[model samples]
Target: MTYAITQTCCADATCVAVCPVNCIHPTPEERDFGSTEMLHIDPKTCIDCGACADACPVDAIFPVESLSAAQREYGPLNAAYYEGREAGSVTSGPNFHAWGEPVFERVLPSGFAPVRVAVVGTGPAGMYAVEDLLLHTGAEVTLIDRLPVAGGLIRYGVAPDHPSTKKVQDVFARFHAHPRVRMHLGLDVGKDVTHRELAAHHDAVVYAVGAGADRRLSVPGEDLPGSLSARTF
Candidate 1:
């Protein structure tokens, strides 16, 4: 079976850059690039070399045979993307540079007003969403976090020595100063403030709360001082 792109794909296009056969459709250069929800692998043309899988930073690509139950549908979804393409649509090779950068313009409806959104977390994901929304719309964003200090696990979990990895924090920190973006720190949504409260203040509430929990082991001393999660270590 061919490789498939799953839900975790943020459309960074790293897979397209490394793919040898150029079987992945909708390269950033294509007309439907930003319009499509996710990138798709051409099952018919994919050589299944697994290069794209290696290049994916988020591990969103998988060989069809190895797909988990939740990711199985991605195989068909990848195939479906190609079905909608025009008959003559095909990329030559390594045309990612040709795609150029995505240009977004705000197209508002008549009598419309600026939207308001309350994001539940201030981590990379939430901030990235804020950055994307601000670039596309005239929306006011309220970033809510339970901790007194922001940055989430990125500030606490990442090693101090890894400067390059943590450098992304600097980029995210800029949103805090944006006029349309507001920060609500030391505020728990359910305990400090109700969901209804946020709903009354905004058009939508987005939960970008990251997955940082440590799973349990049946062995003794699992909670000992020496024991630590990878996220904490």
Candidate 2:
């Protein structure tokens, strides 16, 4: 029997990055990914290689035979998710090969008034949002960050020895200079600017604030005075 993804799934799609076969449905490329309740494995296409299970961070996958009685219904549920849907193109993994040329088209309306958008963090997500919006629309993006520097983890969290990793932030440099993008640093949103004030000043506000917390350690003496989180250390 094939493996099935059960109810505890977080749907981060890291599993898709490792699967050799393109057997998953509503992949990250799909427009409905953010809205979909969960990702499903196609019973007909799954090779049973178990790579998706290995990549899953939450350990949500299980072999159909190994499923608990309560999860037995998931086998049919997974299959039902693929009903009437065709298999997707294999865009990832070592087996991936060249595909046909992609078509370019203009999706947004032409000559629309510039949209003033306040993006509430300057990490990779906020930078990507600014890049995508500026590429597609005449949006004037304002990046806001509480740190004096613009980049979130790229500027502070990443280890300094990993210069190559930090160098990738160079790609974001051009965005800082983009006429459409405005950078505001060392500004706490709730303290200096209220949500109401931001709403009144811009059409939309995007929060890319990185993870709010860290995993707590369970070891003895973990609470020692010198202890520091990776973000702080």
Candidate 3:
């Protein structure tokens, strides 16, 4: 059976890097990659190797046969992405994501002091920024979150039924204990620590705090009791 990419995709492109046959479409280098909500797998070219499923950071990929009733539509959705496009079309030169030359030069100048950075959130975005800083730069990171626990959206946003989706939290937890990282939880930015205070201590303060607004259905009784938004429930 072929694998399918579902809506939980973060568009991180980790899956694309591992697919041996290159069945996943719209590699990060492609012009359309940014516009597409999620990447799709070409069923015709998929060899059922499951490499993409293993590499997916958000657990968005799965076998077509295992899709639940709500997710069954994704199987067709993945196939629909390549309706008119020819097989092996993504492997062509223009769409191929080729590796670039690596530069070993230091980003910081000689005698430059290491900077302190503060990332405000513990979700995927915040953790990614933390990972990039620790791996690519010499910045010391201070991680902050209003909740007592970490894993902002991954902990609260995802449904409990989908345990696999929540597994990504383990990946983010690694950076929490990094030597260069200092974590503060249950600390409100404005009440506990003001923006001016953070700016004073850090070279840069990144606000990865996710959106708080809910979508409007514009229908009667949408706001009535027993009605719950995705985050509210």
Candidate 4:
């Protein structure tokens, strides 16, 4: 049996770093890491170490034996990522930076004091909010994302070919890389860290989460498989 990284599992690589046998694939450092929706555990190599479960901040990791019926599909989904792997499959390079590294550079106005702020989502809104906050105050920013990686919909929801729009992720990378900012990746505020915890840690909490679902088209066959909303598409 093996532990499966679930829908809530962020592709942050915390589990990958902790795994003794290196069973997890598409670690944040890998090229495909940024593109992957979530981290996938290699069941064949898992050894049932439980390191992944321990490392996961959102508690998204679960042993196969203990997986609820709803989560059972994740077991195959994780393995499917490496289905075609030959003896020597090429691996992608790391796409994300370490906690303290500079992902980008920013200019600030003179005489600013660090403000303590917590911004959620790490998407365009979150990135822009943090950027504005940084310029306005000397803020100790904590950027939180449910996924292991920071970029939100830009990483998961966006189409890969949309490079122009995807550039926004770079902006977020730099914001996260900022010295004043502390990126709390994989931390789901309500779960890994609570609202109260955030209130105690920061002077204010700014929620940048986007709208969850779009207004339905309200037409026939809208529920069919071919139908997709702007957000879903």
Candidate 5:
């Protein structure tokens, strides 16, 4: 009844943070996380609690019993990640502690003061930054985005066919209305609020604004008017 991570895995590591048994592999803390194509579940250590599946943003995790024919291979692929490693080792994953145990102190010192932060994007990068600041520190976040809505890349960059990937917006949206959060949408930074103004108010400012550029087709008419990139179209 163990769960497995399939090809659709986005490697956002959301599941890794919630797995009660820490069965997910190549966690963000691991060096291989950057190069790993996708995350896997260690079937041997999985308690079949279905926590990873529930936490998966892209719906990449599924129960072994429910895997389709094409996805069934993932069951073995997941188990192979832990084949040469022991569960309790550092490289093997975060299984050294007991299930649901706190591996590290996530709370800040009681004497720490709450600092205001201005994040200049409402996309995944901006929201993820906000999430960490709010959860791990006593920082007050001021969420700012040029668009009327939050969710930068998650809202615009992801294709319509990949609805599962969009589910992550729900995760990021949770912090938009937090007690310590102040949202400012439909406001351009340079035009409406200057960098100095943000710096003057907040102790820190994070610019998670992602870059978007059109790919060159190298065609003669590619640069002509009325032509737009797929991202823009």
Candidate 6:
């Protein structure tokens, strides 16, 4: 029997450090680690130790025997990642600070107090809002996103080849690295956490969620197979 990591897995790779046999594929250091939607466990090498399940921060790992009917699909997804790979084939590199460490010794403004704030998204607008709030107001910001990974639409919607536009992700990354920022990835505000809960935790809530679906144009044959919306491809 083997355990599998599911959709809820954040790809943080905390479980990879604990597994005795290293059955988890795309470990944080792998090239695919940054791009993979979720982590996968190798069934052939798994010893059913359950260490991965124990280490998962989001409760995404589950043993084969314990998996609910709804989670059965993850079993194949996990195993498929390693179907053709040789044992111990995966590897990762050392953490190189390509962008030099941020200057931390600089003095901050006096009379600036930290304000508890909640930001509802992690996209360009949300990140920029948080960055401005922190730099200007010293607000303690909590950024929330529904996807397990942050960077919002940049992660899911942006095409990989758009490197120039993708550079904006670095801005979000800086916001995420700020000491005043707390990220709640994989959480849906109205579903996983309520507005009341946020109200209780924060002095104020700022909804920086970007515009939703693009306005639709109504015309004949709009539903044809070749049709695609500006908001979605």
Which has the greatest lDDT? 3
Write candidate 1's Cα lDDT for 1-233 as tens digits: 69999876767677888877778767887787877778999887787689998877557789999999977899999998878665334566654223446664668896788899999988877887899888788899999998888787667777887554465567678889899998989998899999998899899899987864777777989888898877767
Query: Each candidate: how many clashes?
Result: 1, 0, 0, 11, 1, 0
TM-score of each candidate?
0.57, 0.55, 0.76, 0.46, 0.83, 0.47
Give the range where candidate 6 is weakest over 10 consecutive residues by summed lDDT: 91-100
Q: After superposition, how far is residue 80 of candidate 5 from its true place, in Å?
A: 3.8
Candidate number with greatest TM-score? 5
Candidate 2 deviant stretches above 4 angstroms = 1-106, 212-220
TM-score of 2: 0.55
lDDT of each: 0.80, 0.79, 0.89, 0.74, 0.85, 0.76
Output the worst ten-in-a-row residue range by lDDT, candidate 3: 89-98
Pairwise lDDT winner, candidates 4 and 6 = 6
lDDT of 4 by residue, 1-233 (tens): 77888887656566877876667778666688878788888766667768788767557888877889998899889888768864222234442212336554455556655558889888877887887787766678888888787777787777877654465466457777788888877787788778998899788899987764578878999898988886767
- Any idea what lDDT model 4 has? 0.74
Q: What lDDT tens digits, residue by residue, belong to model 6 across residues 189-225?
A: 8999999999998989988777556666788988899
Q: Residue 31, candidate 2: how far off, in angstroms?
A: 14
Clashing pairs in 3: none
lDDT of 3 by residue, 132-186 (tens): 8999888999999998999989998989997877888888899999999999999
Model 6: colliding residue pairs:
none
Model 6, CA-based lDDT: 0.76
* Position 157, candidate 1: lDDT: 70
